[model samples]
Target: MEVSKNAYYLVNDVLRAAKLYKLPSLAQLCRERLFSASPSSLFGGGVEALAGLEEIAEQDEKFSDKNSEDDPHKQVEIPGGSARTLNDDMKFALSDEVWADTVLIAEGHRIPVHRCMLVARSEYFRAVLAFRRSSTHLTTEAQVSNAMAVVNVEDSYAGIVRVLRFIYYDQVVLPSLNRKDAKGDSDGVEQEAERAEGAVNDYLAEEASDQLLEDLVAADKYRLERMKRLCEHAICVTVANCLEVLAVAELVHAAHLKQVAMRFVQTHLAQITAREEEFRRFQKDFPPLLEELYASLRDASREEFLLRIVH
Candidate 1:
């Protein structure tokens, strides 16, 4: 289970692959090795390693100091300056109606947005606007341009808003889940008192999972590749959402995400199959995906058996 010092750089890449491949033991070992290994080991020993660590620490301190500043309107001072202020400004602009030239309607909810921002942030929006202008009559160009443009989008209000927020801030802002308080007392009454609270916590988790799925779908439709990958990472971390994410991945043709979810299912197949109700629903909705999962499981079993026999 021990990773060699020479293989430190490979540990992180191997960890990610191991997790995706459903090798929990290997992933855990890598995780422990990564956290336990010193910077000196990672960079190699001697004064050079010490100098590099100091340099990294100094850079991190400067970055932190810059972020801790209270100025929200600090202009970009250099090429690719820190974007905390810019992200804040863009988020403010997203809510400001005075300068917005376009309104995006999602699920009957009108969202005011700057055309320039959308065009700058999303290629899909840029192409859509370009097509509109090209197809419009020249006589009505001035009149149409002067008037506010309204575009109807066929996505849930929350989903569209999540995508818009990502476009504006370049961050995925997931809803915060409140942690349930742990009771010290082991009495039945104390445990009974927290049963309702536990239920509420479960509900919040489910809500967050649904929002993640929605964000994934929206990210895919809008062709936001980074956001899509982020959403997939978020979804893949939660085993409870694996089935749903797998279905969505199939629908969206997200090959990597589908593979990750398939592996998760394979790793936890016994527990997943134990939940007859949920498993049945997933099978009913995604029969092809279920078949693929079983095929992968069979292939994996065959490989494992052959390896054992060879050993």
Candidate 2:
């Protein structure tokens, strides 16, 4: 279908404004078009114009891809492949290399790629450093806030680092089993020790407790499972002694806690019964939250929570 002239003019006007204003991404244009523009007013530039714009964008992307092939900045040569388009694997590898450089720039660190061999001996530590170093590349407050929220919610240094790397570099670091020569027993032990050392270093290098909490919240929103698990584990392990964390944990893991609430009530019956006032206060304050949590869990799973009162 053809776009009407009036609609085309409006779309062009918006696009021109967007280009002139130097917005970092097309998201703002999309938001303005979808939310601010009236449906009737946008009729001329409606579906057809939008489709045409998308087609143009795709063509531009292809043209850029073609130009990149001849771009001097990307002058890597492949054997017997002068005419062929770059494969996905090659593109991914190049992207990773570029992201690694970007991470260094963001982190305010200056370790050259060659020197990275020794510095990156510990993958986990390297990932953490990259996260702290590259967060600046996010460039927008919303992006920064979202990333921070993910990190806070996940509550694991490793998990937070992984998400940050994905956000900043579009790469996921997967764990793999490494096979070493069975004969090199001493070297294997030394390597293992180094790994342990790196883990300790990362733990020590982590941000403050408050910052970690914020990161855990962010991680949960971003659906970084590993980070979420780590955060939960950390709360149960390291911060369990803290009453504030214990309360927050109850709110966060309410459904899981409810599943085992009977057991918990029985085990801590003395504490609950003895501190009736406190328990009553907690129930009153978090009743809706607890109910919502239980309802969600019951809906997802076929388990209902039954409570009994004993006089």
Candidate 3:
């Protein structure tokens, strides 16, 4: 159970060799053992803390022996492939030409994506792709995988990829989305000449702080509740993004995030007020929030004055 790193890779190396040496049967056995012994360490964490379930209802012994030898394949209509937890398979799936089904154009980069994944996770995409049922809708220049869909997006490639990661894994690895957020900037967005473009790391933007606001917008538009909460958690109080958070939260209709942003503004009111540019931006864009801040301060002052008089 507590295998050292050296032992771990040594087993993996043997398994690889077995397969290469025309011994898949040996490789398969070793692979199963490797999977059972601390799968999290092997997969780089985020696997369930443990595997298998005992409390799961046992099938009545009456139904345990249901295999048929007369016919080999059951339900041939179902898509056949190795049973995979693609949630952890990004590097392979994103890179493998065969798996990608959609093209996401972002920040001058054309990102290849899986259509099945987008449809399953995003309601916006479901509608977008469903509408393009007619073959006449696809554009000539469109680069499509599985002849599925194409989408254009204005956000940074990094930001959009973060969103895609969320959709593929939920909160476990990434949280995906649904619907209007699916059909953004509808021009050249999807293959109609396309269906369209695409949550995230621990509010994980590998680069700019603005990723929070971008994620919030995508979450709100795509109706991703968990992603919204994650963004809210990442939208911390800081001088740089304080006002930006408030404005963007309002624009995205994030009432709770708006309240949180407002509280930060109020707590830092003295400092925020001293900054004329920030204060004017808030005054112009969020007049109501500015008024609420003033009103709260006045009430606090009045209460303090009353306490002094009583003393």
In model 1, what are the clashing residue pairs, if there are any? none
10 residues in a row with least lDDT, candidate 3:
53-62
| Poorest lDDT segment (10 consecutive residues) of candidate 2 | 146-155
Order the candidates by lDDT, highest first: 1, 3, 2
lDDT of 1 by residue, 104-175 (tens): 998888999988878887888888877877776667757767667788899988888889988988899676
Candidate with top TM-score is 1
For candidate 3, write residues 92-189 as lDDT tens digits: 56566676777889888988888887777788767776666444455554633347467887777877777777776664223232223344366665
Choose 1 or 2, whichever is better by lDDT.
1
| Ranked candidates, highest TM-score first | 1, 3, 2
TM per candidate comes to: 0.67, 0.25, 0.55
* Model 2 lDDT tens row, 235-293: 33222122233355564553342344434443454565566566566567777644654
Error of 1 at 281 (Å): 3.2
State in Å the error of residue 34, model 1: 44
Top lDDT prediction, candidate number: 1
